[model samples]
Target: MALPAPTTAPTTAERIRSACARAGGAMLAVEGLEPAPTPVHHLLDDGSFATTVPVDSALAATAVSAGAAGVHAVLELTDHAPLPLREPVRSLVWIQGRLRDVPMREVPALLDLVAAAEPNPALLQVNSGITDSGTTTEPEIRYALLRLEIESIVVADSTGAESVPLSALLGADPDPFCAMESCWLQHMESAHRDVVDRLASRLPMTLRRGRVRPLGLDRYGVQLRVEGDDGDHDVRLSFAKPVDDVTGLSQAIRVLMGCPFLNGLRARGV
Candidate 1:
């Protein structure tokens, strides 16, 4: 089915934020340095991003000096899919701003916020002196909390590249399905060829002959990529109603596939 274009443009802020939240880590590069991309743990909240760097690192020194000199150092934070996929990169967010050192007194509160939102085990290492393997010892990794005061934000993805206003980014929320999308899509592609074929029946007659593959899923609907002889086409199979949770989403999928009764059965097993 051909879905109507949205009345307004899709904001990249939501996608960028979603990617960052799920990624947990990002490739951070400081401007004027030889592309020394370092893996930094990041958390995004309140229109800004907080990252941790080793106190003795060169990057930390550079950022502190730049912030003291009143120079806004351009920093780039790139987030991608953690799972193995054909196209791993979900989105890229370029942040332009001045980096300031977060005070030692405030680091615990900030870490608490991150732990509450993400609950990543890495945060436990930052908070308690325990590693993933449950080993406790002296603090081996001393980190300095740095806050990037976002001046400008730019995002790039399959749709295209665009700059997102900081206000919009702060106001927007990530897609409900962002965390589960990869696992669900990968499962559909690998284990459920029959189900995919059945869902393809909803495609328009003219385009049904093309190779239809599951492209993506969101709160609004499912997307299928049709690779035809001429070119590729994207068709959206919107649900009968908006879904906010997994139960509603399952019912919506069953309705879309013309098998409302399938809810009782083990659909995932199929």
Candidate 2:
């Protein structure tokens, strides 16, 4: 069946933020340097993000010198799908901004903020614990915290590419289901062939015969990719109502399947 046009386009800010959070890591590109992969610790509500690298690394040195030179070096952060799929890259969020070294005096406060948002073991490893003799062990690896002062954000995805305004990005929040989406999708594809078949029945009669696979799932709906003889078609099965919690999501799926009794069975597996 031809997919119905969406009443409102999905917000680019939310999608970009969620994609970055889900990927956790991104390929950071700076001019005159090879792109380096770094773990993203937090996406601040201010439309900026924070990452850390070795203090002695080339990237850190370049950023420090660039700031001194009054040259605002552009940095691009590219995030990809964590799971293997027909199309591995779900979206890319490029931040055109100036990279600056976080001052030593502010390091502790910044780390505290990052930990409050999303803590990583690596953050803890930055410093060694105090010994019984009241002496602190020096850290083996020293890290330099850097912040990207966002000038602009460009997000590219299946729908299309658009530049999101800073105000919009700061105002929007990532989708609630993002963190668990990969696990849910992988589980549906691997162990629930029968459930997938049932979902296919909801498609248009003409397209029901195609190989139907669970393409993705979000709070708004479930998506299926139909690999047909003609080509591929993506169909989105929206929930009867938007769901915010796991219990509501379960009921939404059952409603979509037109079989309320199947809720108990699906619950056990999901």
Candidate 3:
């Protein structure tokens, strides 16, 4: 069965950026090196991305060795639901580009750029125990910072796969609530199964037979994952209109649940 598309779907750039914004970790593959998985990464205001790897790891060593002339690399980021499901991954973003080390002198500036996106505590430890006298107090652990210069990007999801232009990516902004999507979806799954059931009722009868779980939420709508005897299916329920903030999102969700005046989400910081 053909899944319904959102009436007001997010643009490809917005969707790709949103996926990256929510991704907790990504797989880094440098040329001639084994793919390394790192939980520490941040997308900068520019199209490039910054990531930290253990100082002693081969990936870090490769960055150090590559020096001014960087190595070709690809970073694969997956967007998945926080809650467990038959298929957790909703989308995959592959970033292809050059990878090189960010000099220690410039690390602070990089951190500032990432801080605007997420004030991760790991940023503080990235440059630990270094003194003003140009000396070093070796900390228990040290990390090497590497930056990826985005040459091209490709995004794939249930709908299909396509390459997004760099110009569009640089200009697009992720959904305002992308950062809160995981928390909101998880809350619905755990605290309000009835809400999920009501939304699932809107799906076709074939999908209703399967176990339905919340997959994603955006200004446009909510997506559900259906796990059935055959396989998994993704269905989107677009809002009557797109919402831009929490109040509008709450109203949209309540409308989806057939209770426009409901106050179930306001107390929870929806």
- lDDT winner, 1 or 2: 2
- Candidate 1's C-alpha lDDT? 0.67
| Model 3 quality (TM-score) | 0.87
Instruction: Give lDDT: candidate 2, residue 88.
Output: 60
For residues 61-136, what per-residue lDDT tens digits would candidate 2 score against the true structure? 8877776342244444555443455666666777777777777677788888889878766576443355779987
The positional error of residue 269 in candidate 1, measured at the CA in angstroms, is 18
RMSD values, in order shown? 5.4, 4.8, 4.8
For model 2 the local lDDT of residue 76 reads 48
lDDT for every model? 0.67, 0.72, 0.84
Q: Which stretches of candidate 3 lie over 4 Å from their true place?
A: 1-7, 131-140, 260-270
In angstroms, the error of model 3 at 177 is 1.6
Better of 1 and 3 by lDDT: 3
Local accuracy of candidate 3 as per-residue lDDT tens digits, 1-270: 997854677889999888877887788998677787666667676768888766777888888888989988899999887889877778899999999999979988888878776876666667577788978788766666789998999999888999998889878888999989888888999999999999988999988999999988999999889999989998889998888999999888888889855665444446
Q: Tell me how far the alpha carbon of residue 270 in candidate 2 is from the true structure, in angstroms, after superposition.
A: 19
Would you estimate the TM-scores of all the predictions? 0.74, 0.82, 0.87
